[model samples]
Target: MDELKIPNVVCKIEVYAAVNPSEDPDKVRLAVSHVILETDYQYKEGSIKATSNQLNSLVKIQETIKKHRTNKIYRRQMRFNTKGDTTWFYLNKQAAFVDVIAACEEAEESAMGPIKVILHSKDLDKVVDWLAPEMTE
Candidate 1:
């Protein structure tokens, strides 16, 4: 198997998830933690937020895409959402809570709510390539 290469690009990743009144903040926090491992988070009324500057922070996402064979899906979404130096995508919060990285094509796809992930980098194309490279059959 070919080894996955981590991009050398410098970037900032910001993740956000809203806590519905009926939802537990702790569970929401868990979902975020499972997705973006080992990062300090900020709790606000009805929301959870975290940020990281390291590419390794995306290791979970990279591994999940490879494991689930969803690289094409992610690549398409990331490219579609790209805006200049930044791009954003949504993940199913419920799947995240279970430590599964499931991407949401739309916010409504995630029943409870979706975790919004925003990525900013000088070379976003390179970042996207690293995260979801074209895989061969």
Candidate 2:
């Protein structure tokens, strides 16, 4: 696979996960970390929130989408969830824990709850294209 070009845009990316009584906080943090690079994590009442203002944070997700040939799925999710300058998607928590980036169409798809990733940007279309381009054979 060739190198992916990270979009140059001012955006705020946040990954959130609810920490259930049966789940370990550290494991939740690890899951979020695997998805977003160098995330600044914040722990609150039964929840974990991580934030990043750089497009580089999405590099791993971009690579995973290409590697798994899931670009259309991610692009659809992102566009479908778009509202104003923000769009969000869900990821399977268990898949993320093991360093696999999996996009979920709904939160209930993941047995242990899903990781919610939100993106806010004025240039949302550019960001989405960079993250998951329309692949052509």
Candidate 3:
């Protein structure tokens, strides 16, 4: 995808899930807040099922990844959800936050499931680098 058309700000991107049409916004936002806090999301029994791309959370994520950009990193796609009003691509949380400094080399994969990182075609590189930087010595 062309990288020139992607958005740098998190609010500009979008995400969705197969949530009940009658789901409450406050509930959804609250559920999303949990994911944002833990830096991961997973559907459990009776757990809130919602789709979100909350702006402040996303901005904090962007900043956190930038803060850890200098460390050795791994980037892996956790899952590929179907597209609706928005295209959603989930990523491993370790790719965005954890530092596997004991690996001796960059980890090729991660088990930190369900942290979604929304990427635009135009700004793909910027986003990837933000989350998992391709650095040099």
Candidate 4:
């Protein structure tokens, strides 16, 4: 009989609502926060490599956000370049972080829903560790 050994690894997750409360706070803030934190911890302990596309996507998002804020008065509603509000970042094949910015925006539109979220980290393991303490046992 052969004995099987299980690999030891821990996953951590953190959920955050990316909406700015000042814009239009909503009740979904707590829900969205929990989701982001939970997801963050779940994928924290994985081996994933940051890809150029993911990095580029993050940069573009940030730039767009900056532009949006800069010309705030011109646009009545916040708009994202992506078709929907959801944007995701991948580390190799696995997603390191998922930004729910659109979700947050939608939440706001619905009278305080959830704001969008951004997940990012070079070391997935570390992120999980950071989030672990915040979760309920």
Candidate 5:
């Protein structure tokens, strides 16, 4: 008999500055704060970045995009220059972290743009399982 092992999923959280530079600084700061708090992503003046392999952090990233109304890119498809096994999904942005985790438990497809999740399609199931283990109600 053979045993299967789940390999670690590597995903990156890439946040591009979608807002116009002329946009209100306070709003932008507030928006960026949510991202920073949730993902602990370092903020850049124009566009910022971060990466995480942790499931909870990833869930936090998605929820931030969904909840931040000033987040212009929320629920929009990621503008990846290319696509392959990797599917960059944006959470339509929130319900609850657990709810999103639960949805990931079932659906292969995710909402478009913000809450940007860049991952390989091959890794989707593995990533979801890693994020949310099956639970009994």
Candidate 6:
């Protein structure tokens, strides 16, 4: 698989279980959960989920929270794109985030369609905010 450099200031990423109907109409949907952020700081090990929309917003949010690191140092919850057909996870470490993104990119390049990531983030509050509404059963 080819490794691509992560664009600096990515701040947040939202992975979606994307389905290419042209490649395989029968396999039109998959859960692409695992969006994350890349920070210079360290965090506990865990998991969380989020949406592409929320993930995209973090780039701006990061600017706001950059000076308030102490208050913003945890993972956020998972959310579905308002489109709601896909899922995502957010992260803060490039090394850890790369493994999954690389694999997915490879799969797509090789025409393997969509895939899912099951890892969680280290920040509990963020996880709760993302998953709470759906997990309330």
Give the whole-model CA lDDT for all candidates, comma-separated: 0.91, 0.92, 0.38, 0.28, 0.40, 0.30
- Provide the lowest-lDDT 10-residue window in model 3: 99-108
Candidate 3 Cα misplacement greater than 4 A, ranges? 1-12, 20-25, 33-57, 64-74, 78-88, 91-117, 135-137
Error of 6 at 19 (Å): 1.4
**Model 1 lDDT per residue over 87-106, tens place:** 98999999999988999999
lDDT of 5 at 48: 38
lDDT of 5 by residue, 1-137 (tens): 12223346665545332334554444433444444235545455544344554444555544443344322332223323226555454332233222332122212242322334455535655554433323223
- RMSD, each candidate, Å? 1.0, 1.0, 9.7, 17.8, 9.9, 16.0
TM-score of 3: 0.36
Off by over 4 Å in 1: none
Q: What TM-score goes with each of the models?
A: 0.96, 0.96, 0.36, 0.21, 0.40, 0.20
Comparing 1 and 6 by TM-score, which wins?
Answer: 1
Per-residue accuracy of model 3 over 1-137 as CA lDDT, tens digit each: 21222234453343322223554444444435533433344444434333344344444444444456532333433112323322334433332333221111212333422334443434444444444454554
Clashing pairs in 2: none
Give the runs in model 5 whose Cα sits over 4 Å from its true position: 1-8, 24-26, 32-45, 61-82, 91-115, 120-122, 128-137
TM-score of 1: 0.96
Tally clashing residue pairs in candidate 4.
Answer: 26
Residue-by-residue lDDT tens digits, candidate 4, 1-137 = 12212113232222333333343223233333322332222112221111221322233333333434422321212223222322222111011123222222233343423333333344433322222112222
Q: Identify the superior model by TM-score, candidate 4 or candidate 5.
A: 5
- Candidate 4 residue 124 Cα shift, in angstroms, is 10
Which candidate, 3 or 5, has the higher TM-score?
A: 5
* Model 2 lowest lDDT segment of ten: 1-10
Q: Where is model 5 poorest over a 10-residue stretch in terms of lDDT?
A: 101-110
TM-score for model 5? 0.40
Better of 2 and 4 by TM-score: 2
